[model samples]
Target: MTQKTENTQSGYWFSKIPSKNWSEKFFLYWSLVWITVFSLIVATEAYKVFYDVEFFILGLFVSLPCVVIPYFFPCAADKDKPLWDRYWVKANVWIALFGFVGNYFWTHYFFVLLGATYKFPVDFRLNEVPVFLYFVTHAYFISYHSATTPILRRYWTAFGGKKSTLKTIGSVVIVFAMAYFTAFMEAWTMEKVPYYSIQDRERMYTIGSAFYMIYFIISFPMYARIDETGPQKNEKWSLSRTAIDSLASAMIVFCLCDFWRLIIGSIINPTNSIPFLGTHGIKA
Candidate 1:
């Protein structure tokens, strides 16, 4: 009875269970696990890394949303259009707010705990690196998630998926692929900027890539949970639905496109090149 009670919400793809309430919690837990692992791996590799006390706690404030907000306060919608119709930019603001707060808390927490208190070769600056990274990471998440939701929703449902085991595995793959792709692009772009480098994490597949994979896998439902609740009688994207979907999709494309543009800049100007810095921002 006790085991089954806990298993009630445990679903494979999204819920890991049959949980009607606290369903989104699973995602949150995984995100924490991933970030902690990421931070620890990065912290332990002191020769290649320096911890930041300021951004540690700040990461929670902002990152919590990019990781879990959509699951909890998903964009409400009807049945005729995409969930991310016109309000995509507005959603970016919401994500940025979390980024600000998250960066504030997490940076502070890790800075002290990890003794990122000292400077490395680059002289880590809170205003420049920690806060800036939080802000940018938040923006990237908005783009990544907003874009993938529609595709995931469509893909899952299209595959004869109901709310059962099929969805659980499928959900993990979808979110993991999306996140992995995003990371790949970001790492590629970091070639020049190199602000978010992780040379030390390459070895700790469990702490870095594997941990990230688990985060995506476990949190599969948060992004797709609402859609699983069943759509309206009609299948057309509604104003809210369209808004969410389009905005999410657009933000994702926006990130990928800019990342590619960065590649182009590197190609065109070999000596002194920069990506879409002045052209557009990459906040989803």
Candidate 2:
């Protein structure tokens, strides 16, 4: 019974490294692969690779691998379970969904608040974002969360392995630091990409990272507990519960993001806009 209890609790937060299954390992490796591929594309200024292809087609090329791979990769935790029923695969799909939704709605905050610009070859857009970017964001979020998990686990252990007030404080500090680091890295890496631009690069790196960290601040920890400890002790989350939790995380971030816009406005924009009741502030 004790061993069964441990088995049920074994997941992202409960374990130091959560790649206990083939699907989990694949998620991590493919995330690295996507990051590497896009980094090279940016470093090489491979604009033709994107521009030559139809935006919709390119979107498919990026998206299909994420959808197709997990269904085939069986989880070691429960080989008898169907592929999609595994925890990591469900987590991947939901995170990818967040990526797509985030690009549609959350990105406009960057455009309005930080004076960011997208120089896409096509005019096709959803909520002022290039359509291909939705797919790109999907891949990026997978990579980001994949990288976030282990590091957070290590930090959580380092600070204190037990539940206590100090550990809680340490967890908050670690989360903020990790969130800020990842957000800044995201800005730094894509700075070379010609299609994406932000006004006042320095401010974007500094102040804008704090603003962007809001996304991970909510998402990172929320995602860690998806399959462990739910309505009942040691009970695994069902697909519906996994999705609901994922959507709840994104929605919380969405609300916090808009709240930032309403209360803080843009410090990165040259105009130094004041906060207002709208999605973005007007130049003062």
* Per-prediction TM-score to the true structure, in the order listed: 0.39, 0.82
Minimal lDDT window, size 10, model 2:
11-20
TM-score of 1: 0.39
Q: Model 1 segments beyond 4 Å from truth?
A: 1-90, 105-130, 159-161, 194-201, 204-207, 212-221, 224-284
CA shift of 253, model 1, Å: 24
Cα-based RMSD of the predictions, in order?
A: 18.2, 4.2
lDDT digits (tens) for residues 188-230 of candidate 2: 8778776777778898899889889999999888876666457
Query: What is the Cα-based lDDT of residue 86 in candidate 2?
Result: 69
lDDT of 2: 0.69
Superposed model 2: Cα runs more than 4 Å off: 1-20, 52-58, 76-79, 155-161, 269-284
Q: Which ten residues in a row have the lowest lDDT in candidate 1?
A: 109-118
